[model samples]
Target: MPATDLVTAELTLTGRITTASNATFLGSIGDVAVVYKPIAGESPLWDFPRGTLALREVAAYQVSQVFGWNVVPHTWLRDGPFGEGMVQLWQEQDPAQSAVNLVATDHVPEVGWKHVLEGQDESGQMVALIHEDTPALRRMAVFDVVVNNADRKGDHILAMTDGHRHGVDHGLTFHRDHKLRSVLWGWLGDALTVEELEGIDRVSEGLNGGLGRDLAELLSAEEIGSLAVRCDRLRLSERFPAPSGEMSAVPWPLF
Candidate 1:
């Protein structure tokens, strides 16, 4: 869909975010928290791969809006300390909380709050993951599958204090093929709930209305067609389908 027309002024860099993979800077345009990443002018990390990463991130955010999930608010692409880049409205999450702490063999009563965990690896590299699930979230998992999201890490889920879940970091989504790799496997063999089917139906119906035309500008025809196919399958099955090929199962260490 066409992005919401939110006017964002040029943000000024206030400090450095030492924990991020790229050269992230903390900034603000008015009262909004902005994260800035400049294009690499020198040697760069292989994982980021430069060039189209910024565009991909923007596209992902737009797609997330279609799923009706709370996402890190995307404003616009702009010139930054490095070069052309993206600026997102910063989401305030508990810095000390993580999903790992929430999961246990003993079930915790579903309080409907999901926590986003941001931490460093053994070598002190920053990483994030999501760690909360409810009946509502299970529906989101099915939405991720329809989008062919290749990265749905635990850190991507953000837990707000008021018991709402926000997902982030969707740059690696909308593949034309089945590339879904996530850590949400609790419902591996469970039947798809009726609510889940309804959610998918809403998205599919929205596609033909406005969403399809908008996505056509950013995604290939094949990719959009694949998304429709996924929706149809879910609607027909009325439950989670068994893994058909190697790609259907969740990927390990989903980050």
Candidate 2:
């Protein structure tokens, strides 16, 4: 069956993801499982305009595809039982692994991990936020920067059983202003690898092609321009960026 046909088929909602800030439902199209977020169900944000979240979610997927990072799952906009919404192919994450963790300060790994920050836990024990220093996560961090992702919570990173990582809940992306609040700040100030640079180059070159065209449909002209500027800036800097701006560097309730 064609891709469109698969998505257009009756989506039977199996359960609701109540933990999601927005209305999110788990459903299946025939045998294919998916996550659905209807445009009508999105709560209006003071910063982000209303009804555009679903489009932004789809646009994030498009950017991931252009960079060939496979960081985001297959996402698209379609009519569902609730209304028009964003639907993404559901990925089962490994139960035992998480991309980000709060380890006891002394338990922090000496190598192969980037320590983000140190803080006191609920029991008054000192803990540190750390993420694995791997190429897959680095790619996701880079993608988040380019998209101006504002709410990259720790739970948003999915660790697959095959060792691949996926980022989700990208509705808070692509703002014209710099609103990159994320927990993946482990690579700050590190130089971009040759392969990472090549990925940026690919995105830069493709902006005026299919990627640009697809984004134009979802974002305003100025937003698209801003995205292009971010790509060019990252390519020129050739390094992972440090947190800036007067706003908080990371999202609240870090989990």
Candidate 1 per-residue lDDT over residues 12-129, each given as its tens digit = 7898877555566778776667777664522253443445445555666665666666443564567766777766777787766554343332344356434333456566666543
Output the worst ten-in-a-row residue range by lDDT, candidate 1.
1-10
**Ten residues in a row with the worst lDDT in model 2?**
1-10
Instruction: Write down the TM-score of every candidate.
Output: 0.72, 0.98
Q: What tens digits encode model 2's per-residue C-alpha lDDT throughout 75-148?
A: 99999999999999999999998889999999999999999999998899999999999899999999999999
| Model 2 alpha-carbon drift over 4 Å, by segment | none
The residue pairs that clash in candidate 2, if any, are none
TM accuracy, model 1: 0.72
Compared with the true structure, the alpha-carbon lDDT of candidate 1 equals 0.62
Candidate 1 deviant stretches above 4 angstroms:
1-8, 15-24, 37-50, 71-79, 95-97, 100-131, 241-244, 247-255
